[model samples]
Target: MKTVTNISDLRQQVKDWRQQGLKIAFVPTMGNLHAGHISLVEEAHKHADKIVASIFVNPMQFGENEDIDSYPRTMDNDKRQLIEAGTDLLFTPTPEIIYPKGLAKQSYVEVPNVSDGYCGESRPGHFRGVATVVCKLFNLVQPDVACFGLKDYQQVQVIQTMVDDLSMPIDIVPVPTVREASGLALSSRNGYLSAEEKAIAPALQQNLQWLAQEIQYSRKTSPDHSPDFIGLAKKAAAAIDATGMKTDYIHVSHAHTLQPASEDDKELVILAAAQCGKARLIDNLQLSLA
Candidate 1:
């Protein structure tokens, strides 16, 4: 509906909304919205009286050689989807407004231990960028609650840990990963897949599915050595490699701390990353292999 690009204008509007006794819900996105993003808006609408969603293509969250320039930015399409999904206000700010002093000059937020594994290992500073921008958004909107999709499971873990550690009063609600009928996790990056890469894309999901199945079979057939966690990790890697993936990292970790699982009955997160041509993809499935 209404788009407010300036921070002061958005703040004045939200102050008015709060005076009316409306509870606010905020959803921060990097534009290029899809069904997965819409899914977050739906959850926010259900929980808060006033919904404020911001479309910011953050510069801080990107790494050297990463797709900051190539990353999708479909603002017109994104606005229509949010309005149709019942988002009340669109706070689309320029990078200058978000990081007035510039990214290099802005303060950052961090969460320990939880950021030690998974994507954190390869991307380096990626999560810090994420935490910083998210913290900025939180301070900007000051919503009673915020919604994030579980598709970015590690990100959710990081933000949840940050809120708890700092005693920030905002409630963080997480929605499950939304997928296409073919099983690929819906992402803005999916737009980068080539014709051949698109055909090969579902294998990311297939690899995670195979990891789940392998754990099941390993438990049934060889109950004596039923839960060989390391073997499951290797099998997941082999599946990704066999699928023509240029690997990033495949990890099996505890669902909470994200530390690699070493014993039985521990919840496991099977996360894998790889590139299909120039497009990078990630997918994960949580299972009880122990």
Candidate 2:
């Protein structure tokens, strides 16, 4: 795969591909690739003739005390993996290239409502940084389609909402979360987990699955009654905390809006985030009441 670091060169390559009438798919990431990221590239292959993957660690997304400096960068392995995954173009832009005017001067994008709670609440200005950078990349790559992982459930919602509100023509495809055999959803942050924390990590997914089952059971057994989502969430959070991990939030929300779920909402998602050693792990399970 050819790697282009500058915006002009990247745009020229995409322009050349467009002249040939080739469709392109994009997968944007913050380096430290695992199997989960590769899965996104694999999904991109199904959507377009050429795949453009970008690795830019945006400082705008990280909060104060959220050490952007320590975030892992494994470009050698990342390049090898992208090549194997059939990525046709890799855009590795420096911070200056991405934010020429600096973040304070950079124009930003924010999708409201869906970007309001969960990770949005936990990490202030996170989605603004996300939406802004993604908008910038979308303009630079101008892919026919973009792929994102559902492990970042709220993020997908935010981007989708942004695309719709802005009326961008690109299709936003969400790939499923890739996980270890123990059921822990794969994340770049997972690398920070100590061996013991790794053992305790899958509890996040376990509790989510259990909560989903309970929600389904309640719907089936008591068709006329609300399932008490708040209570179910509390139980799941307590269970996760019992595993010695600090629960950030365990919420049952309407899958689409990421708002608190109501009994009438057929499509639901259970989203959670927790502190596991040095890593902050997030996971979700989607279910249908209908």
Candidate 3:
């Protein structure tokens, strides 16, 4: 319920909580919160004694020509939602506070290999911004556990890789993607969709689900061809295109490394990003053939 914009104030409050032997959970997000984001805070409660949610529309994570300026900022509504979701503290810092030395001079973090494909390929330098800001938040909050939504599947893997490689002491927990009755993955960006576009948007998830089922069914039947993954991806892309949305990338990859998957790979995930109307949407589903 309490909101502090300064880093020192945020840390001091956390320090007091630490003295009380309270385990902290952190959820970092941009301002425009929805059920998807609140779900993260709700999930955080099961793992820690207190939850600290941050709202900073990270400029570092956005690319040139991206919606940096127009990205929605609903702080009043976001605070209300976070408080209602049982978040203990809200850290809402300005860009200057986060990057005191200025963005150009600030140190950055990058997780190679895991961040190299999928969204990484579509938006260059995106993961570097994500890893850097997340690292900053981790250092500032020093929580015992952090919760991230699995809607950004590759992002989850990237952060997991960063934490394991850097030996950061925070446990990374991934909450499942929250969706609508219509099967659309709930996202802050969903706000950008027009009514007409909204109706068609759920097709993205539908296509991904259809592909997952096809892959699973094919493997179960012991098909000779092993289900052509590449062909399925292309067909999925074409399906999205038919819906009048532009497909960014639809890829099937090894769930852990985000690399192209082979039939022998037991764990796989299908991830896709597409633009519909003004909203840029992403969704994924994980499968285990093992």
Give the whole-model CA lDDT for all candidates, comma-separated: 0.85, 0.95, 0.92
Give the alpha carbon lDDT tens digit for every residue of 1-290 in model 1: 77999988888989999899999999999999999999999999888998999998888878787878877778899999999999999999988988889887889887788877678877788899899888888888899999999888899999999888888889999899998888989988888888888887888888788777877787788776646667767777777777687778887778877887755555878777888787778778898755
| Candidate 1 pairs with clashing backbones | 265-290
Model 3 spans with C-alpha error above 4 angstroms:
223-225
lDDT of 3 at 74: 88
Candidate 1 vs. true structure, TM-score: 0.94
Ranking by TM-score: 2, 3, 1
Model 2: CA > 4 A from native: none
TM-score, one value per model = 0.94, 0.99, 0.97
174-267: candidate 3 lDDT, tens digit per residue: 9999999999999988988999999999989999988898888888898555678999999999999899899999988988888888878889
lDDT string for model 2 (21-45, tens) is 9999999999999999999999999
Clashing pairs in 2: none
**Best-matching candidate per lDDT:** 2
| Poorest lDDT segment (10 consecutive residues) of candidate 3 | 219-228
* Model 2 Cα shift for residue 246 (angstroms): 0.5
Q: How many residue pairs clash (N, CA or C atoms closer than 3 angstroms) in each of the candidate models, in the order given?
A: 1, 0, 0
Tell how far residue 166 is off in model 2, in angstroms. Answer: 0.3
Judging by TM-score, tell me the better candidate of 1 and 3: 3
